[model samples]
Target: MAAKMKGAQILVECLKREGVEVAFGIPGGANLPTFDALYNSPIKVILTAHEQGAAHMADGYARATGKVGVCLATSGPGATNLVTGIATAFMDSIPVVAITGQVRTSVIGNDAFQEADTIGITRPITKHSYLVKDVRDMARVVREAFYIASTGRPGPVLIDLPVDSTVAETEFIYPEQINIRGYRIQASPLIDRAAIHRAAEAIAQSKQPIIYAGAGVIHGTAFAELLELAHKTHIPVTTSLLGLGGFPETDSLSLGMLGMHGFEYTNYAVAQCDLLIGIGARFDDRVTGKPDEFARRAKKIHVDVDPSSINKTVVVDYPIIGDVKQVLQELNRIVQAPDTRAWLATIQKMRQEYPLLYREKEKLLPQFIIQEISELTKGNAVVATGVGQHQMWTAQFYQFNRPRSMITSGGLGTMGFGLPAAIGAQFGRPDAVVWDIDGDGSFQMTTQELATASKHKLPIKVAIMNNQHHGMVRQWQDLFYQGRHAQSEINPVDFVRLAEAYGCVGIRVEKKDDVRPAIERAMAITDRPTVMDFVVEETEDCWPMIAPGKPHDQMLGTYETLKQAGGVPQHRRSDPDEEAKLSLG
Candidate 1:
């Protein structure tokens, strides 16, 4: 332990102890002392274009590597700018440690220059927050923040250090173990035999079963356990948006994403299953459109580390609260494979009958572009996305085979998250090919980060699907608003010029023939990030659609979708047995 160390020096040392190799942030007046300390530290600090970008980059790094990402910022607006990024991480359960500089402790209430109530401002968004008043507590605070951020049900934790304390000398002693009284960091790894037995009994009795997985499985590194359980039971799997890559999408049991814009058969399987085993998944409202109608026939067994998420949305007949990997290990040990050939046959029939379809087009389609990218990458890339149509396309088409291969803002659905996130992903996994699949509007929001990546020589690939409008909102208008375009349209910017301005090589892929060659060229460039502007069909809609205010089964894709809404053909609704099936009894 150092006999005398400044608060800033202590913070840097604590970060080194936490094994943080790289952090993202922009330094300002209030955080200068901390930045000065960072200069002499072993950890590499990436100065971003903006604080929001820094927060998102940290989140991306954390999500990509399954490590607690670190970010730094100054007071007032600098701290405030991090609110959106923090909220995004909190919503998605990404682990991050956000450090912000504050005003002097004496003038905190007086609103000194660049002063802000950082802890209070970020309180709602963070898993935990602290306002450091004493220099002696600096090391302990940093250790605690990392501990909380990376523990069970990980999310962002914030620590606000006053500028006064940053320069104050203190005896440095890092805490070996945290003793937060009310917090339980680890769920008991001991298998509950009774719970395992009950779950096994339920599975044994179930004629039809479906596994609904989410991001927690990936966070817990329980994909192997999940896969084993699925294979042993011969059950099919459907994942939430964030859960992409948690299961091998190329597997026969895999049913891609199950929510709005999900596969028709996947939604049907979820709705019709006698037992829906939700592994590390919350029944999010987005996943369960018309909550009462979602998976009504299923007797759900929900497994999650967070107790609050269980039974919060859809009803659960059985709740298992523990680490996903641990719980899954127990379930796999006790449960035997049931004869689900008949149920699987029915699902396979549905899958073949009503597969996802898109019209062949002469104009370049965003879906086609994304699908091609997936094929080229072969599910090996660390793919990130900005929210909107592009995000959905990436989620649907890309076959994510490994954990941490797919990164997106699932819960918050933040626009402008892709480019910066890809930068972070590239930083964390430099050997992996990192792609930012982005929509024009979303890309425009955080495109300035291109400079940061370019300056740092991060060779990330950015593919912008330029649709000339806010495509998701436009799709909504096209569907429900009598063809009124309304205010969904936005001005188009020349993305090639924009990329060049940021010192990045820009490729324009307007024709189908150019797309592959352009991608190859971009992949070959290892010196700096590459941007590709794909001007896609202006109003192309994402298919396998579940319209708003409708059940997941009420899909509208092809003419086949109209054939059945409630299990029976639309024309055979009056049939007594078919009607019974429709009633979901």
Candidate 2:
């Protein structure tokens, strides 16, 4: 018997068929029917304080679970609120399905209230988007949205469902399969023996070779193969910002993050390497620095699922289009370890000579405080960071040992992402200790989320790296703009007092030695949320920066003039000779 159902009911059914167990969002007038339909379904709905928070939560969920994160919101303000989160997910290539309720189809073009053009607004950000005008097409549209979001270079997809359409009766027949004539996800077959042979040969011949992994490593679940490859080849590994947690940063072979704000040794190794094997990573601007000059000396073999990414910006010697897990497994079977002892020795020397420096002074520096907290927490706590200096420092210093241990807005780098995201992360892992590493500048942007955490009784430890200025922007000004600090300072508030007002346990730390005691005390008290305001040095900057539009190896900060000058490596700086070796183009 053919049964009739509301478009909203069909949407839920389609989602369920796609194995979506939970959706995060907030309800408003235009999206009432979708909320009503969710009441009877098995799919769980998590209500967030703001739509933007809900979208980010979904983005985080998708990043964590490797499934398409779904978020729902009403039209206009609600939909618009999800824009930042949506754009962030898009920039990161995270799989997310953003469903926004719209005004009635009849009034869509009539200047109605809460009637924003979500499709038009979100087109550039989302992988694809749709406007559901006909109720009968609801099931089909939803299925397509989920498919598109999960496949290829994954990203967010927006579906604007009109309120009137949600209630309209439609035949509910979930399609058994999806067929689109124009849409195709291209991937190479694993049976290509020649390509595999060449990749293996590339591995065996190079002396100074490293494996660079990205967020795609996590998405493709290639961590095991990556680890195996690293072990088999005895190669040092470095990751991009999104690539954190894909490998245990504490591992001896792990070089940590490599970028403008990455470790001194990591960026140096990228510059000096003769060969670079990038798995599940796009050579993005942040990672590559200058497209023409990035990895100039290294012969690169890029293994990614997306073909379009191959040699798009940076030149790739070998581009393998397949899932990273599959390609790495194949390469592992064919490749033998190159004698990298000399190479490893060089890297070790570089690491030992120019270690990540956090200056020790009478007053506290944020890095020292974060490192102390990390040590105190024993790497068990989940660190969530807002954008800028605090985020880079946390990524640099914190030894993330497990998957999803570090959550930050890496791709879009949305400031004020700390408090609400920390709350959402706490919910995701209720048993794990959660810490919000925020800068005072970024923290003030979403300080209101303190209320959300306190209201829900989420035991999130917020450690404000309370530098009274926007540290990252200030660093740029100091280095490139001749120290003319503009609009970076803010009248700092008493974060402890603010936390206290929100019914949270608060502590203030101004001295270097007080950091550990404060964190230990906060960790001991788990009954409510805790905030530790750490008054830190304001002028400190993230070093090893490859000046904007320069090569990845061309760092603006300290670099050795000679190969062993001060026992430091030469590739750490953006010398023209180093650029001549790496063939990015």
Best by lDDT: 1
User: Candidate 2 lDDT, tens digit per residue, 1-585?
Assistant: 569998888888888998988788889999999999999899978777788888877876676557788889999999999999899889888889999999999888888998898999999999999999999888888999999999878999999999988999978888778997777775446445577679889989999999989988887788888888898888888998888888876566778899887877778899889899998888888888888777789999988888888898889898888877778888898899998988887877777666655445567887777778778877778788899999988887777766677778877899877776677667666787989899998888778767767877888999998889999988988877899988988787888888999899989999876787888899998878999999988877776577889766567655443222332232211111322212211
* C-alpha TM-score for every candidate: 0.95, 0.91
- Write model 1 residue lDDT over 441-516, tens digit each, in one string: 8998898999999998888999999988889889888888987999888798888898999999998888988888
Runs off by more than 4 Å, candidate 1: 189-191, 558-585
Candidate 1: Cα lDDT at 377: 83
